[model samples]
Target: MLKHGLDPADRRRPDRLSDRELADRHQAMQGFLTVAGPQLDQLYNLVGLSGCNVLLTDAHGIVLDQRVSDGDAQQFRDWGLWQGADWSEAAQGTNGIGTCLAEGRALTIHRDEHFHTRNTAMSCMDAPIWGPDGRLLAALDVSSARADQTERYNRLISAQVASTARAIEAVFFRSSFPGARIVVASDDPSEQAMLLAVDRDDLAIGATRAARRALGLEREGAIRPRPAADLLGRQDDLHGFDRGERAAVIRALARAEGNVSQAARALGIGRATLYRRMARLGIGDEPARLSHD
Candidate 1:
């Protein structure tokens, strides 16, 4: 038998919301929905093929928008799994949105994993969506049936959905916080962080703080005066490194166990370049690996 926590069969109670609280959540969702526009439609089209039901929920866990397969929507609605329904464990029982918010992390809740008996037939993957200041703004979830679900497949789809959500957030931040400084902080300081500061025209004006920290700067002033590309440690010979570069660095560090040489080798970049990129990206230093020689 699988261990309780490891087996994904654990039951968790939901937090019940008052009518007044629900009304407030509804109002907040309406604000977000008004701004959703084309991006929401685009996301619906992109994830339509995963045979998954997509939902956007406010930080409070009320569903704002739901995009389900045409035939499946009715069935889900009949089951009380429809647009505007609450997905938080507190209101609806143990569920994806509630558990994710409760834990404040990305999660996958598989068949029979929910605390509520009614949710046993569903599998869900959810990731928190953050605002420019890194506040929990919303959650993006993809839910499917248990009949054809696998842990691996759920993870894959969840990752894709999370990536799309992140892209959307980047756009949201650019639009909502124009000319404001934005930084991404990680638990692992060695991991490259991204700093984005856009001008009123939606063009990047500066990238400090998180970007400097990603680049391994010790003092704050080290990166304040430098160009974003220079801080990122990209060579003048090459074009600007995009978002993928930061993702690659994070992946390499994770895979190589924070060994600079190993990560550089895995990334197919010279150690110097990797070091420069790390410094430019605001990745903190990892423990030096002992030489085998």
Candidate 2:
């Protein structure tokens, strides 16, 4: 703000959402609210006692939900921390919701760390809420009013808020695909905890954000349909089945109704190559036909 020739000393708050804007944001966040509802309520209760506020914001930083204690709502509102507030770092300038989105990690922004001097007395801790597909769905935050805020108290609240964020992520992935097997791949407890979703055959179909981070995947959708063993760090677990190259070919062949050419197209392999892999996998005599019918 200082560089823009605007004075942080002016301490201007962002605009509140109009009725239509609030409705649109709520409509867009319906799915996120479904998974995050329980956690949101729990966090609200937890922070209410501290005279703080809890907020849930969409990935774009739109305020989807904002809650304060029984008597504190109006006070927080006067400060511009309302249900329709746009708290993205761009809008609020280095506060919890916006900074969390920019960093993609959980942490606290205390007092003077805020971009505007107006926010200098407030402190906030925020954590990212993610979807089953590893996309950021929303952020959960607890903000302290300057009057009663303390550096030590802020640190404790930050950890507690992050725990709730993890729970929200778990709910998202579990609800997204209940039939899929969920597993923890890391032996180390300190590594970020995550769940890998596998098909009935134990092939990986998807993963939570922590699992992707553990595997050093920098992008979403990095986990493809492959043997879960690749991430389990255990090769022995893969030996029990005729999987992958063979199973993909078999499933393709079955889907093609025994037409080798059609199966080749489906599997993205040449007819001869498919035949060769099938033979190498010791299924050369396998009958190719429709079991589905």
In model 1, which range of ten residues has the least summed lDDT? Answer: 1-10
Mind giving the per-residue lDDT tens digits that candidate 1 earns over 57-149? 878787667788887787566555555566765555557887887776788888767766667888888887665445667888888874877
Residue pairs with backbone overlap in model 2: 89-98
Per-candidate TM-score against the hidden true structure: 0.56, 0.75
Q: Against the true structure, whose lDDT is highest? A: 2
Candidates in order have lDDT scores of 0.63, 0.77
Best by TM-score: 2
- Model 2: CA > 4 A from native: 2-6, 188-193, 216-218, 237-293
**Candidate 2: what lDDT?**
0.77
TM-score of 2: 0.75
